[model samples]
Target chain A: MNAQFRRRIASAALIIGFFVAWELLCLAFNVKDIVLPRPSQIIVTLIERIPAIWPHAVQTLYTTLVGFALGIAFGVLIGVVIGSSRLAYDVAYPLLVGFSSIPKVAVVPIFVLWFGAGTVPAVLTAMILCIFPIVVNVATGLATTEPELEDVMRALKASKLDILLNVGLPRTMPYFFASLKVAVTQAFVGTVIAETVASNRGIGNLMMIASSSFDVPLVFAGLLILAALGVALYVIFSFIEMRVTGWARRKDEFALG
Target chain B: MLAPPSAPPHAETYVALERVTHTYGRDDRQVKALDETNLKIDKGDFIALVGPSGCGKSTILKLVTGLLTASSGYVFVAGREVGAEPVRVGIAFQNPTLLPWLTLRDNVMLPLKIVPPFRQEYHAKRRTEFRDRVDALLDQVGLGGFGSKYPWQLSGGMMQRASLCRALVHEPQLLMLDEPFGALDQFTREELWAIMQELWIAHRPTVLLVTHDLKEAAYLANRICVMQARPGRIIDDTIVLFPRPRTIAISFDPRFVALTQRLRELIVVASPPKDSNP
Candidate 1:
């Protein structure tokens, strides 16, 4: 078998072995359901509650996706504005750093007060949490263009915008893709936190409702489902990163374009 | 390849620096990098400026390319005053600085897509023709099949070769080299020196190469100018007078060794004495 195939199978085996050991240990220790449930019990509950759980999972996915889009659009827009101009970078960067330092969870109540307890608060929370990294990464990528390359461009009589278009934007792709991967995962976390505090729709709300009734197995299942969704979104972004920014990537990272 | 409209039909002085002095910082902390340096190159002349580090060899190159303005001198290139607007000039540095995201072909074609007269029609009916030109230039530099490869896929020497192609692709009337082959291995540097000479011979862009290597200066340039230490200015000018198609064998000739030895001794003499605080 190829090395990649062998590595994949070995990793899969380790994950499966971990769960098997966890299940056996749970029974051997006679662990209580409220504290921790066996993996098998969680799996059975997930299958039985699939129909009821699917809608909440879909709602969480929708909110996170919508908020993620908002973060990327505005984050990149603001990032480019700040990155391309020295004045904007100097003025906006400090303000952004100060703003990102404030916890998004602390601002959830404010968003709820403005938009009410629903998807709006959840989406806004996700956007607020995820936008910082995107802005910082994009701005850094655009700002750190090799000065020597800039010299070459200037010698050719290229204007600033011309240099930015031909070199700056393409150079930012790897950083941009890396930011997307991190931001997508952070978006899910933001959505869940908002739903736990202010919303009534997502898998976060479902977990809250289930735990309140002491349905411990169902709560674990909801968490597992959210994790799966997060992983799925991250994989999608990674796949697109490989396709679009292949030239910027190392061979071990993916492969040269 | 369209020539820059500014080029004069009967220009004698392609690049000239008249009493150029450049100061780096402001006020008391200011450092004079180049002090009243003067140089003039006729059309299609190839010259090398040899000096120790921080001797302002690079400052002169930057002045001619309009990367930095002279503190108090009249700099001219292609018959226009420097610092007015950027003129058509090609430059290569020690680092290839090829964009990692671009294929070698795309990297070479970059200047064409940016500079004026050619940029006006880069993507219209001239796209295929431009591609062919880039291919031809790459082939000329021993990088024929490597055009589709990205920068990382190529060795450092290959990358530098591509860089030379990129600098020349726009067909600028003047080419500047700031230690273009200094970072490569010894063998690769010698090989690239030959390639550079061939390129210069084929398309004689008025050239100015700034380097620390005396042998490199002797082997490539028609005239070698040695500079003094800090606040650099040329102290000696020696004409090589070597016949064309000059090969590596010339370095072993008695006259070649003597010339390189003399230039080396001059550099040592020009080096500043160390501080004697004891």
Candidate 2:
């Protein structure tokens, strides 16, 4: 097999080996179910309870996706405004920095108060958590375009609008993709935080209920499911990123490899 | 210096700067970049401007191209005063500056997409024709089958060669080069110079080149114009008497050696010293 295939196999082996070691250690020590659950116990709980867990998992995914989509739309619009001109950058950037510095978790309570503690608050929280990165990344991409490149474009009688269309927008793709990865994870956190604080459904609420009822294995199972969801979504976006910004990656492949 | 003959009969100037002065900054911080600089280049004349760093040689290029307006005096290109409208001018710098996201062919075709008569019908009837033209230009520049490749896949020399084709693909009447081959090794630089000469001889575009290398300026330019440091102005304009189709062996000619050395001394004297007399 090639190096890439070998790498995939190695990672799979490492993961399986870690879980097997954990199961063996728990069996050897006869750990209590309530005190320390084994990997086998968590897996058993996950498989048996997946039907019950599916709805809550869907709820969390829905909230996160809606919030993330809105965040990206508004984020790119506002980012282009901030990035296009020196005056706009000066006026809007400091305000964005000040606004983004407010902890997104702290905003969850405010959103709950306004939207009455359902999916609305969860989505708003996720949006608040995720939008900052998109705005920051997009603005930075436009702002950092090389002046000499602009010189080359301008010499050909290309208007500012033409240059932005031809050069600035395409240049922002790699930066936009990078922020999407960071923001997707943050969106999950925001949804969970909102759900745990007030909602009656979703993974965060299910885990909360399990923990309160002293069902430690079920709670661990919920955690594992949420993690898998996050990883799956991250991998999807990473694959898309490679396809969309293949040129950007080619320049870095040699240096990084 | 002996008295020079009057203006090139009937003032046959394709590009001219009449007592042009340029200053940067505002109020007390204002600094003089070019002071009463005057130059006139005939149609299809290849002129090399050599000077010390910060001597405003580039300022002249910007002025003629209308990228920067002069503080005082007139700037004319192709018998008209340059203003907001961009005249037919192409430029290449030291760095290749090719867009990384584009294929070499697409990068070369940028002007056709955004510029005037071509921009309006860029996709209409001539799309295939324009694509073929860029492919031919790339092939001419020794990048024959590499038009499909991204810029980063090429070597530094190859990238610079692509840059030259990109600059000229639009069929500009005036070509401005700002140390276009300054970053390459000796062999590559000389090879590019030969390629540049071939292109120039083919079309006879009005060319203005800014360089720090005296020999490069002497070798490629029809007339060499030396400038003084800061508050820059031309100090010497000498015609090269060598015949066309110049080969690499011509560097050994007595006259070529004399011209390079003479221009070198003029630039050395023009270089700004920390303790020069005010």
Candidate 3:
């Protein structure tokens, strides 16, 4: 326990050292505050602008969560359908690839035109950006179930649904959780980009306003908050991943270490 | 009025293969896996298939299980022609293939949940009974108290034992094994042979085992069918008159050695002759 504590302390010190060096470099270079604010200035600005930034932060969070959820739902549904049938995969995969190739941020104007400027456009942008990972991961997972196991199921005279539920779903869960982590990150990025282009609300909009006024510290504060939010969401999903895939972890521990 | 009295079920063949041919790939480049293969299996017979590699031994197991349809001929199981219809067949593979997400008990209980009659009644009435049967089978395979563990928690031998228990849990009339113990060490493989013999003695499921081990073939089977390489056809159908309740110690018996040597010679002859110089 003491050793673990010391290790954590060392990690924290390393992070603190990094921040101190960054601040010192900015000061030594006599950089204009608008160009690159020090860490201390960013923190102070964060505290001062809390009331102005809070609502926008909340809006960004809401849009990201809703879009991320929708993305996962639709992606999993379509992915499973395509993965189950060769004909569906052949017909839909080319179209999916074509659509995914379009820069998601470029569609923000179209989405704003379609849904009007509010949470809807931001959410749609996030959904479009995040859905691909879930679909591809789920399709690959479903397609790659062990043939030997399938044969065993077949010999037992199991129905198609039975094989899917009992074998396919359980095996694909690890892949699903892994892809979800990537998708959630993309969801946050989509929300920010969407808000930057067209919104009176959200952290991205706040950053835009700060940039126009040359309030560099305030812009940095907004970026810091977004980073924190992204990190927090990622950590939460990672915890869920650990819980869902506890069996795999245990097996790995036994096999490797 | 009923038709004339039918033949007794015991006298009727339980599984039959007639002029079965399986060809892989398309025309011109097609390779025959099985050619005009014919065999009959009685209700409670224990049969072993032995051959050189690429001899389609595993294909025969697949054909009987209806996992693959024959290219030309008819196959029957329990007096019914093979099609999409469900039959009572249990199978174990070279790899254990247990569902990693499920506990050992749940893995074993998979068939009971899926196969009908049992499936319809599974959630009701027979829940505890089913659990008890799984536990009993686990104990029979020396896996008692390990059912709560996951497949990855078990060793290779233990996992294979669990797989056998899983295959037998539904008590199907036919059991097919494709080199089930081939992946284990020699010691573990021999141990499982005894366990399998005891299990077969207690529950006489008609079994078809595909193996490359001559000693394994001689020790466990009542009859061993040897097939030629590639366009495989049965080259030798030898019966082992070994007594029941045979143990691994039988490997030391002179007769066992003679039987194994005879099988090895047949396999060598059946294989494309290798030009080896002393």
Candidate 4:
């Protein structure tokens, strides 16, 4: 426990040092606030714009969460189906790859036209951007199950569903969680981009308004909030991943032990 | 020294392979894995297959376990054809192959969770009883306190022991081993051989082991079937007269040495000469 405390303190010090260096660099250069606002100035703007920024933050969060959930649901469902069936994989793989290759941001206007402004377009855009990683990761996990283990299941007369439930699903959970970590962050970015183009609400819109008004410090504050939110969401998902893969954690502990 | 026991009366054949042949690939690029092989294993018999690489020894084991069907021939388990019927056959490989995401207890219970009669009652009332059974098997294999651990946490030997417990947890009638101890160091391998011998004596499951080690074959098997190289055919079917319960000390015995030498000679004779080496 003492060692862990020391490590935490060390990490906090490192983070503080990084921010201090950034502030010092800006001060030493005597850079303009519009180019790179000092940490102190950014904090002041954050405090002043709290009322304006909070609602937009909430809007972005809503769209991001909804899009992320939908992406995971559809991605895992399609991934499992395609992964489990060779025929499905053959049919769907090229199409998924082709769709994924198209620039997601370029389709934002089309999504805006379809869903109109506000949360729906933003959420749909986020979903389109986030689903691919989950599908690819989950599909690979399900498909690469050990042949020897499969034989064991067959020898035991396990049905296809039994194999999927008992072996396939549990095995794929780690991969799914890993992809979720990536997808959630992508969802945040996607929501922000969608809002920048189409929505009147959200942090992206707030940043855009600040930029046009030349409120550089407020723009920096909005960017900081988005970064903080992304990191927080990522940390939350990582915690959930650790819980879901408890068996793997125990195994790792044993190996280290 | 104790005298060897006589063979039990009224031994019944448990597995019979009649003129089994397996050919891989198609007409122009074909390779015969097993060539018209015929063998019978009586109940409680411990048989080992030894040969050079690509000798179809592992192929035979796969065929008996119904993992791979013979191209032309019939495999019978317990006097019934094993084509469509699922027989009670346990298997262990060179790698432990325990699922890394499951606890040792869960891994051992996997077959039970999948296999019927146990699967039906597994979720409700039998949880405690099932756990106890898993505990017993783990105890038998010297892994009593490690049930909550995962595969990656264990050493190679421990993982292999867990795998052995998993294979036998359901009390399978036949155990198929494909070079199960091939990856271990010398001492661990010999130690496992003793453990395996004890397990076989206690359980009396009909075992078919495929190995490249002549000494392993001589130590454990009632019969050692040596196979020739690719498009592999059985070259020798010699019965081991060595007494059991065999120990690592037996490997140093003069008779064991002579038997190993003979098997080595057969393998040397059976192998095709290399053109580029000399």
Give interface RMSD for all predictions: 1.5, 2.8, 2.5, 2.5
The C-alpha stretches of model 4 lying farther than 4 A from their native spots are A1-14, A21-36, A85-91, A246-257, B1-10, B275-278
Kindly report which residue pairs in candidate 1 clash with one another. Answer: none
Q: What is the TM-score (0 to 1) of chain A in model 3? A: 0.91
Model 3, residue A207: displacement in angstroms?
Answer: 1.1
lDDT of 3 by residue, A11-122 (tens): 9999999999989999999988889999999999999889998998999999999999999999999889877766887788899899889988889999999989978999
Total residue pair clashes for candidate 3: 0
**Model 3 misplacement above 4 A:** A1-11, A86-91, A251-257, B1-11, B125-127, B273-278
Q: Score the docking of each candidate (DockQ).
A: 0.73, 0.53, 0.63, 0.48
Q: Please list the C-alpha lDDT of all candidates, in the order they appear.
A: 0.87, 0.86, 0.87, 0.86
Worst 10 residues of 3 chain B by lDDT: B1-10
Every model's TM-score? 0.92, 0.91, 0.93, 0.90
Candidate 1 chain A, run of 10 with poorest lDDT: A248-257
- Model 4 chain A: weakest 10-residue lDDT segment is A248-257
TM-score winner:
3
Give the Å error, residue A211, model 3. 1.3
Cα lDDT tens digits for candidate 2, A1-257: 49999999999999999989988988999988897799889999989999999999999999999989988998898888888887888889889999999977888888878889889999988888899999999988998888778888878888989989899989998999999998888899999999999799999999999999999999999888889878987898888777778789785543232
On residues A1-257, what C-alpha lDDT tens digit does candidate 1 reach at each position? 49999999999999999999999998999999888999888999999999999999999999999999999999999888888877888888889999989977899999999999999999999999889999998898888878898899888888988988888888888899999999999999999999999878889999999999999999999999988999999999999989888777555344333
Error of 1 at A213 (Å): 2.3
